[model samples]
Each structure stands twice: as C-alpha cells, then as structure tokens.
Target: MLIELKNVKKYYRTGKLNVKALDGVDLSVEGGEFLAIMGPSGSGKSTLLNIIGCLDKPTEGEYILNGKNVERLNDDELSEIRNNYIGFVFQTFHLLPEYDALFNVEIPLIYRGISARERKERAEAALEAVGLKERMKHKPLELSGGEQQRVAIARALVQEPLLILADEPTGALDSKTGNSIMELFCRLNEEKNLTIILVTHDEKMARYGKRVVHILDGRIESITLN
Candidate 1:
C-alpha cells in the first residue's frame, strides 16, 4: 500500500471550541492507483490530503505511508519522507513568477543537494514529459494558466515520487484545460505506475479517476469505482 490511514482524527482548538476537521477517517491507496477525493467545502478532504502528504499530523490514529508508520517518525524524518517519497501539486500554480519554468522545476532538486547538472537534466526531462520543454525559459507571467499548471506538475514529477498529492489541481482552469490536466494525470499513472491522490469538488474532475472516494463531515462517506 502506498498510503493507509486508520481511525485518523484531526481537531483544532479555536479559542475554546474544538473544530473537528477529520473524524476517524480511514483510507487506503495502492501503487499505480489514481484516486479522487471529493466533497463539499469544509468536508475535510483537504485535511486528509494534508495529513497524507505529511504536511499535518493527525490528532489521533495511525498513518502508515509506504509501509512506514508516520506517527513514529520525528519532524525531520517526516520531512525526509515528504521530500524523498511524496510530491505535491496545488490548485494555485505556486511557481515563482521571477523564475523561468526550468528553474522553478529545479527548485526541489536544489533542496535535495543534487548537483546543478543533474538538476537541469531531470527538470528538463520532467518538463518535456509534461509538454513544456518549449516553454522552459518562459516566466510564470508569460505562460497561460494551463501552462503554469503544467509547470507545477513538472515540479512534482521532478522528484519521481512514489506518491503524488494534488489539491484542487484544476480548480482555476477552464473546462477544456482542466480535462487536459486530468488526462495528463491519467497518462502518468498508466505509464509510470505512480500513486496519485487528488482532491476536488467537481464531479467532472472526480470522474477522471479510476476510483472516487467521497468525503463528508471529515469521514469517508463512500467509495466507488469509476
């Protein structure tokens, strides 16, 4: 299993009241699986994604990622897991506006202490895989919304992570563009055998996945094969 969450709960203390973001949620994802997480706003889908991505810790329960118990790892260990095993794509293309596509994609490799030559090679390959090789020198401001999202995808790909977490990846794009992005994700899953878990509220987007997991009230409401 690429991911496993058992009885996970996340609660926040807002002043005196407690906000339950995830209430005893359990989910399992396998390698090469493309899963969609769908729910209305405030449904805790994002929280589940965050915890799976190692961005947040659960208030209770165990999270096993790639056979390792995440709850047993320290902060630095978790950071290493995130850097070496997981990749992320956000709804907003968070590429640096000042940098070109190549450099933006190279940032993650830089953090890994990879040499400049290897970084450029891997980043360029990733960009080409996403059909952005021609725009590698363009700044974020010069690219279209879809192109920016492609760059973000390339950044995620540069890590060659076993698991990719996408949070509303196509939320800002038009229907056509969003479909293209979803198609790209499908292709990646089919070609590379990578595990992909994406969170979205759109029914159309959720349909692109091989399986759809519906979340509500911070729990897994249902799971269906698409």
Candidate 2:
C-alpha cells in the first residue's frame, strides 16, 4: 500500500468543546490509484486531505505513507516528507505573481538546493507534461484560470512526488475548464502511473477517479469503485 490510515482521528479543542475533524477514519490506497474524497461543506474532507498530505498530524492513530509511520514524526521530519515525497494542489493556484511559470515550477527544486541547470531542465519537462511548455515564460496573471492551474500542476509534478494531494482543484474554474483540468489529471494518472487523491464536493469531478470515497461528519460513509 502507498498509504494507510488506521483509525485516524483529528480533534481540536475549542474552549469547552472538542471538534472532531476526523473520527476513527480508516483508509488504504494502493500505488497508482486515483481516489476521490467527496464531502459537503464542514464535512472534514479538507481536514482528511490535510492529514494524508502531512500538512497536519492526526490527534490519534496511525498514518503510514510509503512504508514510514509518519504520525509521530518531528516537525522537521514531516517537512522533509512533504518536500521530498508529496505534492499538493490547492483550489487557489498559489503561484507567485512576480515570477514566470518556469520559475514558479522551479521553486521546490530550489529549496532542495538542486543545481540551477538541472532545475530548469526538470521544470521544463514538467511544464511540457502538463501541456504548458509554451506558457513557461508567462506570469500567473498572463494566463487563464485553466492555464494557471496547469502551472500549479506542473509545479507539483516537478518534484516527481509519490503522491499528489489536490484539494478542490477544479473548484475555481468553469465547468468546461474544470472538465479539461480533470481530463489532464486522468492523462497524468494513466501516462505516469501517478497516485492522486482528489478532494472535491462535485460528483462530476469525483467520477474521474478509479474509486470514490464519500465522507460525512468526520467519517467515511461509503466507498464505490468506478
């Protein structure tokens, strides 16, 4: 398994009340699987994604990613895992407005202290993979919504991460643009055998995954195979 979450729970203490963001959630994902997590607002889907992505640790339970038990890892350890193994795509493109696509895509590698020559090459290849090679020199404001998202995807891919966690990746786009973005995801999953966990409320978007996991009230309510 690429990911395993056993009886995971995340709770936040808000004065006298404890909010259960995830309650005894159990989920396992095999390598190269495209899984969608569907949920309504305040349903804990984003919190679940956050845990899986190592952006936050569960309050209790086991989380094993690529064979390492990560729930109890130190802050630096978790940061290393995030930098070396995982990629994240958010609803907001989160691109640097001042930089061009190529530079934005090179940011991760720069943090890793990779050579400038190699970073440029890898960023170029990633942009090509996302069908945005021609826009490599364009700034975020110069691109359309779909194009900006493509740049974000390229930035994620530049690391060649084992897993990609996309939180409402298509939420900011029009239906047609969203469909195109999802199709791009499909192509990447098929062509690169990339493992993708997409969190979205849209059923149309969830259907693109090989398996759909529906979450409600901090628990998984159903799992369906496409």
Candidate 3:
C-alpha cells in the first residue's frame, strides 16, 4: 500500500472549544491507484489531503506512508518526506510570476541541492511530459490558465514523487480546460504509473479517478469503484 490511515482524528483547540476537523477517518491507497476524494466545503476534505501530503499531522491516528509511520518522524524527516516523496498541486497555480516555466519547475530540485545541470535536465523533461516544452521560456503571466496548471503539474513532477496530492486541481479553469487537466492526470496515472490522490467537489472530476471516496462531516460517507 502507498498510504494507510487507521482511525485518524484531527482536533483544533480554539479558546477551550474543540473543533473536530477530522473524526476517525480510515483510508488506504494502493500503489499506482488514482483515488478521488469528493466533499463540500468545510467537509474536512482539505484536512485529509494535508495529512496525506505531510503538510499536517493528525492529532491522533496512525498514518503510514509506504511502510514508515508518519508520527515517528521528526520535523526534518517530515520535511524530507514532503520534499522527496510527496508532490502537491493546488487549485491556484502557485508559480512565481517572475520566473519562466523551466526555472519554476526547477525549484524543488534546487531545494534538494541538486547540481544545476541535472536540475535543468530533469525540469525540462518534466515540462516535456506535460506537453509544455515549447513554453519553457514563458512566465506565468504569459501562459493561459490551462498552461499555468500544466506548469504546476510539471513542478510537482520535477521531484519524481511517489504520490501526488492534488487539491481541486482544475477548480480555476473552465470546464473544457478542466477536462484537459483531468485527462493529463489520467495519462500520468496510466502511462507513468503515478499514484494520485485528488480532492474535488465536482462529481465529473471525481469520476475520472479509478475510485472515489466521499467525505462528509469530517468522516467518509462512502466509497465507490469506477
């Protein structure tokens, strides 16, 4: 299994009042599987994605990524896991407007302290994979919505992460552009064997995945196989 969550619970203390962000959520994902999580706003969907992506820790639960327990890792180790093992794609393409596509995609590799030549090579390859090789020199402002999202995908890919956590990846685009983004995800899952976990409120977006997990009130309401 690529991911395993056993009785996960996340709580927030706000002036003596406890907010149950996630309530005993249990989930698992096998390698190479495309899983979609669907829920309304404030449904703990983002919380689940954050935990899975190593961006946040559950207040109580066992989260095993690959074979290692998440709680057992310290801050630095957790950072390494996020850098080396997990890639994130958000609704808004968080690219630096000043940097070109190639440079933006190279950011993660730069953080890893990789050699400049190798970073360029890998970044270029990732952009090529996303069909953005021709736009390598273009900045975020120069690209369209779909192109910007593709750049975000390439940035996520630059690390060759074991898992990709996408939160409303197509939310900012039009329906046609969103479909194209989803199709790109399908290609990555099928052709590259990338294990993807996507969070979306759109049922049409959820249907693109191999399996769909429905969330409500910080708990899983149901799961369906596509």
Candidate 4:
C-alpha cells in the first residue's frame, strides 16, 4: 500500500469546545491509483488531505505512508517525507508573481539544494510534461488561469514525488479549463504511474478518478468505483 490510515482522528480545541475534523477515518491507497475525495465545505476532506500530505498530524491513530509510520516521525523527518515523497497542489495557484514559470517550478529543488543546472533541466522537463514548455518564461500575471494552474502542476511534478495531493485543483477554472486540467492529471497518472489523491466537491470531477470517496461530518460516507 502507498498510504494507510487506520482509525485516524483529528480534533481541534477552540477555546473549550472540541472540534472533530476527522472521526475514525480509515483509508488505504495503492501505488498508481487515482482517488478522488468528494465533500462539501467543512467536511474535513482538506484536513484529511493535510494529514496525508504530512502538513498536519492526526490527533489519534496511525498513518502509514509508503510503508513508514508517519505518526512516529519527528518534525524534520516529516519535513523530509513531505519534500521527498509528496507534492501538493491547491485550488489557488500559489505561484510567485515576480517569477516566471521555470523559476516557479524550480522552487522545490532549490530547497533541496539541488544544483542550478540540474534544477533548470528538471523544471524544463516538468513544464514540458504539462504542456507549458512554450510558456516557461511567462510570469503568472501574464498567463491565463488555466496556464497558472498548469504552472502549479509543473511545480508539483518537478519533484517527481511518489504521491500528489491536489485540493480542488480546478476550482478556480471554468468548466472547459477544468476538464482540460483534469485530463492532464489523468495523463500523468496513466503515463508516469504517479499516485494522485484529488479532493473536489464536483461530481463531474470525482467521476474522473478510478474510485471516489465521499466524506461527510469528518468521516468517509461511502466509496464508489468509477
């Protein structure tokens, strides 16, 4: 299994009241699987994605990622796991406005202390993979919404991560653009065998996944195969 969450629970104490974000959620994902998590606002789908991406720790239960127990890892270890094994794409295209597409995609490798030459090479390859090679020098402000999202996707792919966690990646795009972005994800999942777990509220988007997991009240309501 690429990811295994057993009886995972996440709680937040707001003043005195406790908020349960995830309640006894258990999920398993194999490598190369395209899974979509569907839920409305406040459904804990984002929180679940956060935990799986190593951005947050569960309040209770075990999270095994790539055969390693994530709950037992220290902060630095967790950071390493996130940097080396996981890539994240958000609804907002969080690209640096000042930088061009190439530089934006090179940001992750820069943190890893990769050499400039290698970073450029990998970033170029990733951009090409996402059909953004022609716009490598375009700044976020100069690109369209879909193009900016493509840049974000390229940034995520530049690291060649084992898993990609996308939180409503196409939320900001129009229907046509959104479908194109989803098509790109499908191509990556099929061609590169990259494991992807996407979170979206749209049924149309969820159907693109091989399996759909419905979450509600901080828990998985159902799992359906596409």
- Local distance difference test, candidate 3: 0.96
Clash counts for the predictions, in order: 0, 0, 0, 0
* Regions of candidate 1 where Cα sits further than 4 Å from its true position: none
Q: Candidate 4 residues 130-190, lDDT tens each?
A: 9999999999999999999999999999999999999999999999999999999999999
lDDT of 3 by residue, 11-95 (tens): 9899989889899999999999999999999899999999998889999999999999999999999999999999899999999
Q: State the displacement of the C-alpha of residue 187, model 2, in Å, after optimal TM-score superposition.
A: 0.7
Considering summed lDDT, which 10 consecutive residues are worst modelled in model 4?
64-73
Candidate 2 on 178-222: residue-level lDDT in tens? Answer: 999999999999999999999999999999999999999999999
Candidate 2 RMSD to the real structure: 0.7
**Candidate 2 positional error at 125, Å:** 0.6
Clashing pairs in 3: none
Q: Model 1 shows how many backbone clashes?
A: 0
Local distance difference test scores for all models: 0.95, 0.96, 0.96, 0.97
In terms of lDDT, model 4 sits at 0.97
